[model samples]
Target: MSGYFIYASLHQGRPALEIVDADSRQVCLQWEYGHSASQQTLPERDNPAVDELSESEIQRLFRRLLLLSCRQSLHGQDEPEQNS
Candidate 1:
């Protein structure tokens, strides 16, 4: 039988998820959501809007980042609301 597990990743200190399968002597897996997103068949960048942004967009991103920093706790954990 197969088992599923949801783990809150602590590597990148960002929004991350992991699902592990269990049913064999040695089984492990990680669906790297973006191993090479930049190499996608389409021309769109991984984060197209961020990669190609105007002055206003850049400022907006900075503002958001600042807001997030403020909401983050001492444990490096940010409130769910501040996460993407």
Candidate 2:
């Protein structure tokens, strides 16, 4: 994974989050609830005809991504080693 991009939007009339991997161009995560309203900030608020996120929103996204990374790291440590 090179980098990540996270955005908030409405999915089926409900707020949702979409996280994508920049290198693989694959979605890594999606959260529909349990997050604060800050996660719902629209990307257009800071961009013109482009999806741009505000500074605070970007910070929140990065924080969430970091937390997710830490959690995944912990899980990875729990896995048994595999011999090729």
- What are the models' TM-scores? 0.29, 0.39
Candidate 1 lDDT over residue span 6-70, tens digit each: 46554443323444444343323332222234432223456565344333444554564465345
- Candidate 1: residue pairs that collide: none
lDDT of 2 by residue, 1-84 (tens): 345687889766556788886767778777664245645434443457233334444566568778768865765643667899
Q: What lDDT does each candidate get?
A: 0.41, 0.62
lDDT of 1 at 75: 31
Alpha-carbon error at 63 in model 1, in Å?
A: 30
Which residue runs of candidate 2 sit more than 4 Å off their true CA positions? 34-67, 71-84
Positional deviation of residue 60's Cα in model 2 after best superposition, in angstroms: 16
What local lDDT score does residue 21 receive in model 2, on the 0 to 100 scale?
66
Please give the RMSD of candidate 2 to the true structure: 9.1
Off by over 4 Å in 1: 25-35, 39-48, 51-84
